[model samples]
Target chain A: MTALTSAVTAPGVLGRSRALVRPALKEAVGRMHPWVGEMAAYSFGWCEVGGGPAVASGGKGVRQALAVLGAEAAGAPGRAGVPAAVAVELVHTFSLLHDDIMDGDAARRRRPTVWKAYGTGPAVLAGDGLFALAVETLAGTSAGPAALRLLSASLGDLVRGQADDLLFATRPWAGARRVRPGEYLAMAEHKTGALLGCSAALGAVLGGAPPAVVTGLDRAGRHLGVAFQIVDDVLGIWGDPEVTGKPVHGDLREGKKTYPVLAALDAPSPATAHLVTVLESAGDPAVAAALIDEAGGRTAALAEARRHVAAAEAALAGLPIPAGAADDLRSLLDFLVCRDL
Target chain B: MTALTSAVTAPGVLGRSRALVRPALKEAVGRMHPWVGEMAAYSFGWCEVGGGPAVASGGKGVRQALAVLGAEAAGAPGRAGVPAAVAVELVHTFSLLHDDIMDGDAARRRRPTVWKAYGTGPAVLAGDGLFALAVETLAGTSAGPAALRLLSASLGDLVRGQADDLLFATRPWAGARRVRPGEYLAMAEHKTGALLGCSAALGAVLGGAPPAVVTGLDRAGRHLGVAFQIVDDVLGIWGDPEVTGKPVHGDLREGKKTYPVLAALDAPSPATAHLVTVLESAGDPAVAAALIDEAGGRTAALAEARRHVAAAEAALAGLPIPAGAADDLRSLLDFLVCRDL
Candidate 1:
């Protein structure tokens, strides 16, 4: 294997892709109206809340990296994937802005979210502006029509996922049956996997790849996305606050119906009953975590994530891509499912 | 002049166009996910909030009419413009859904707004779904790219306008200078005119019109849009509630910074001072309306609306459309400016 094919951490791949994608992403955001642009910049961690100087704190550019890898796997230059990369990143950021408002999340990446710092009205408008800008940016690319269609369809899926999430979160837990694992996985596929699948498919289409290659990348990305969300559920319960830049057990505190919590509730054990009791009241995070662990929820979730990672890797095996590209994808899959934070 | 060249009432033209466009618009909205489709259908007054039977209560379909007229003027069948018409109407409904949420509006068209009936999260997702579906629908059209670019750019303008409206509404009235009429007009242009211009441009482009014809139609649509907004402002203050389906002096009751309100503030009259004082506190709608009328705000706004209508009509004069098409446009322009509701 080449040096580029060697196992690399998630942050390492993110850093390399961020170096290439951030400039174009920034430029695309800069095209928004001045006030909207400022809010978007703040949301992206490119600047402070009041807009003084750059902060450079942002989420890992996993989607953009996937775009670049997908394009390269299709034998196109990474630079040729810049527009699709930027488009996906913008859509991701747009969802974050609106989701923060809808979820009533006050902070992200250890800083006050846009809605918390500015106001809900401005945050909503800024999100809408980013969405429009995403379409506008893709419309200027050589594969404009195809990319627009993919992005638009992905957006619909994202909205549907969000709607389902909201409905599931508000269900009457006292009398309601435990949400099935299949239902949770389906929602995750829509909420998290759809955009990732679009990211890969868009890059491949823009790179002039064959339909088979696009379909393969999309399936691989979807599996990887599900695995990523499962890992996120794990981290939400037990992650180190310092490393995650989020409060430990934050999702538990918010009473979120994440994968691990759902799994624990669905488990046929006395510990599951205790976990449910704790979740229904103001139980301490440590006790709840212990109950969930004793019920085998943590192990079950981790195992499911591994299964998805394996499936993702299998999906890429038949694709006519370079060995190095496949190796990088496998590394990403591993990093995603195994990350500590 | 032929019979088609004769002046027509606003309802006459609206009724005709609504018959032509509503079927296509309904089908397009019906293509969304079932839940989202239900919310959209409710918002459009096509069904009840939880979805049982159809109850069609909707806007006048003015933008869709303008789109179809634009294409027909460019010598294409009106049916050929259905996709663009549906696209523009979906975008308009999307704005209404989100704007109603941002503005905390409880009711629209004498019924509960989407956010009020179905909850804010579902309303937002439904709006987003409609937006994505708009782009998806347009992507299937022959004029997909150009139409997409126009709609995307118009959406950015609309968001900017909404942002400014929120900023203006939140400004402290104690020491701040009065908002100028120019600023209000500019905001209205962004809020209303951009999409109308895009509708005309997209239709003309779709119909294979020359560049100059498209430009002419865009300019005309913009002017007509401004006039439409001005009339809406007038209706907000003094129109009969039975006709407008809103409370009399609704804008005054809500302290909206509309065209007439801004003009009243700028007028050099003792009523202007008193109106500002009343606006700063809990003012009676009847007194506020009287003060605005006495200050000549109503007259000034009416004059401005007429000027825009004249400009809109003049723009059509130089276009290479059939006389009947030009007459229809002029009739629509006149109807828009002179409407009672």
Candidate 2:
């Protein structure tokens, strides 16, 4: 476990898959409208403000690694998953580009979000371009239509999750109209879980895995997604802004019904009631954070994350895959949950 | 020719295909998120302002007809094209939904747009949902990977064209930065042609046509799209508001660089110079419209449309399709260019 943790801690795991996926992803993006391509580069952090080469590259490429590793799990050449890795990464990029605009987030990766760097219209158009590139990345290949279907269906889930997230924001903070934990979980699963599942499913399918293995990886990925989302919810409320590359306590400020907020509100206590009152008036995010943590939301959330991680582990167990691949997938899963930022 | 014109005037051609595609399209739309589904209904004119049924239906279903007729031309049963038809139409709707937002359009089809009825975020999300559904509609079917690839490739063209269109709006009306006629034609063909071409190509591929015929229909549709766009450009300025269901001379006011504007500007006449002056100061759209007409822009545009229409006819002439199917396709082409609105 220590060795695995250290391996994950070195950043090489994410960087390895990121290196494989980035070239193909950039090529696909380069084939789009040139202006939109520039915006896409900015979205990926391959370029700085004026489209120069970036000092640092983009995200951790977790989904890409899931894809690349998912293929390896099926005993295929890990490179066989490049297309799937590119597709999922492109889809993930597409979601972030649009989500930033819809969520009105100003920063990502310690820089302005795409919509903040470019205007909303261009950002949206670039996002659409990435989405198209995602589909084309798979369709252009010899990958079966089933892989394309897996990718496409997840897109519906992604948008629906986003739509529900937006709608939940407008709902009241208390009473019948209040967003329930179960409902939020469902939305999170759709928004987050579906894509992760699709990433693994796509790779497994393309790698010529049997239906059972493909479906198993998909299930495992989905459970991992739930755990990953819980971690994100925690980071959104409690992580340092500099570390997370976003405004800290944003979920509290946005009045978003993240799992912690819901868990805190769900508990019936004087502090809980006071937390609701503070949230109702759009109170200080710090105070809201304290109230939520004081109500045991943090502990409850960590427990739930562990539960989901266990479920993910259970799904991963008994899979007809090589032992080495299983270890890699488990390590990544552990890294995602335990990630501080 | 008179008889063909009368047949095209009857509206039955559009209606026939519309009826076939509606149920499947509706069923697809119904499977989406309910709230987003309602917004899609509003987008399709399936429902009125408040979610009730509309007396008037949606667009003429030209793309759907292209797909269906394209399959029929390939000697398959017309129903073989249904999935292709649904996919193309969904893509079309997705473009319009997003385009309306980008264009800041408030009224479409004499009613408030999705963004106007719903908010910008919801409308954008609904458009994205429709796009996913479009891909899913094809991927869920037994359509060959080729058909899906054709559909996927065209999305890149569609978004690129759209991005260029937006960028074109901000360019100087005259200069090196001026939107050139050739460039605009290329943009129009992409913005308008790619999907139309894909519609025909999807149908042909799904209907088991050989590559030659599929490629032929794609070319024919691309040419027809240019003609269709020229006709639209003409109407954008000179057509009656009541008949077009839009503000008359809206393109002139919006400063959109349509074919007529480019042509009128290209002609080095006093009227053309005055047209430039008027446009620069944001003079009356009526005056600009008259100046454009005086500079022979209308005639030149019509001639350009006729040339593209002839090119389309030539592309269709030697295709290995049924004679009856060819005639039906030709009739639709003619109807599209000769449409009043």
Candidate 3:
């Protein structure tokens, strides 16, 4: 049967693929120092390495699985490639840890953020340590010179993008009054998409996939990240607390210029104007929910997200993926952009 | 003449070597984008690319010279190794830029620090940019895998050391009473020694020197860094402001627990006890300086610095250095720890 048919008919392929990748991640992480392994286990919602009960829960681990699957899809699945997968996860964790600090967020994964638990200095060090470890892992990989360069360059982009985002947050006046959609897309690409690109690219680099396949996978990941960020922004305002671990309309209250806000800002409406006004003040749930709904902001943002998802799918269409891999990728993309509380 | 003899005979060798390294640094820096080049020129006291006069007078550029001369001492003195030399300097500058911010230092190299000039955000981004650029350069080099690993590992050590230092600083319990000399040495290793070791080893890496020789250079660099740091601590309390660019007795006033301070704390005399008491209190320069003087802290610190300098010299002994290079190295070592101001 075709991958699409298997995905539609059986649907177990997704779970099975996830099962395949999860062990690789666990085995790879087990190699870290006992303390780092414990911290990581806690970070990932695996068994409590900290003497707590063995609670198993986490954000999808989709990025890491994607890295493993990406390598497999390109026809190189082995013990050699697992470290790159670990590296990707480390980079992802580093970003999340630092982002929590930068955003002054207190909770993560149903627990206190690293900074809240360990204090800011150690948290920063932990993040930095993880980042160092990530790059260091690549050195031992058989991925060779070109891959190292690509990884380094992608990291540079990730940090640069983050710098831009932080700068925008701290000094909005420095940015243009109305950022073009292209600029928003670029920002998303850097801040969110770059690591996903690294995930795909690192996989392909390790797998020794042809350049064309690598490029396609990279494009696929970029679009997937863009779609993911848009949906994330939507969920930020409209998501349920149970699902997101964040209060509804939190981003709106915080005056975040998410895609929805940017989209609404671009096309002026009375509702958008109201949003702009209330944005300066914190939005209570009733007012925020109404403002988001009345402006058709969530709907517009969903549509935008779908567009990027479709683009991502189209990009993946060109890749010469292995058996069952395509279905897993498709399912992963679907899971990334489509859940609600 | 031997390096020791020339040190007493001709101090100009060190000065001339410094001159050679300066223009090479300027040329390499000039190749970056106009904005970065401009910032760097202002930082390095070079002329603006658009034919204007120099922005500010440059400092000693001692780190870059160390890298170049160290490489030359290993016997490959050509431009082939210059990229590594340039890269080491960039890494040093990146560290200094961030360190200045972290330390809340206002002046560096007789000019406003990057943080002071461009605000914290830009300064951080610029430092990050330099770091990325340095890695990119090293990755692009023809240097072997071992060399890249060494450089990357050094950078990691630098971060780890820095993280530990910051953690030590912020921990409320880590004051004079709690801080230890070992901790101070560890901080110095990370903050100052790691890069110096990298600088010395880069030459051997480029020269394809035997592993033993490289290890010897590394050991030499570490001892030299310790000696340099001890002298720096001495200067912080007793050096002239015209040379050090900060007030005399600055470390005492800042309540910094340097090696000397920690030593004093270990076995307190009456005056040492009083100095510690003042440091524990307001850290007023007038009171602290008087107490430090009464304690004969300057003489004690100088004696300690002399011991380390001797150790550094001993570490360099027996290495089959190129003719005249050893003498120059010895001279530089003496000048480093023997600076009166």
Best by TM-score: 2
Return whichever of 1 and 3 wins on TM-score.
Answer: 1
- Sort candidate 1 into its docking category: medium
In model 1, the number of clashes is 0
Off by over 4 Å in 1: A1-10, A54-56, A172-177, A264-288, B1-20, B54-56, B171-177, B267-291
RMSD of each: 3.2, 2.2, 5.4
lDDT of 2 at B220: 88
lDDT of each: 0.81, 0.85, 0.67
Better of 1 and 2 by TM-score: 2
Q: For model 1, how does the per-residue alpha-carbon lDDT over B1-341 read when each residue is reduced to its tens digit? A: 33334444445656776788788888877777788899998887789967988665788788887788778888997666778888888999999999998899998887888889987767777888888888888877768577788888888889878887887787643345667888877788888988888887777778878888888988888887788888899989988888777788878888788888788878888888788788888578898889889988899899988888778778888999977667777777766665432
Pitting candidate 1 against candidate 2, the one with the higher lDDT is 2
- For candidate 1, give the DockQ: 0.59
Best by lDDT: 2
- Quote the positional error of residue A337 for candidate 3 in Å: 1.9
Least lDDT summed over 10 consecutive residues: which range in candidate 1 chain B?
B1-10
Give the per-residue lDDT digits (tens) of candidate 3, residues B1-341: 34455456335644564566666667655655444455556556565334379666665555555666666677777344566667777778777766776677888756678767766545555555566566666667677456666777777777767765765555432254477767777778767777887777776677766676677777777767776887788778767888777787777767676776666655456776676666667567777766665666666666766766677677678787786667777767766665442
- CA deviation > 4 Å runs, candidate 2: A3-10, A240-248, A268-270, A284-287, A339-341, B1-10, B268-270, B339-341
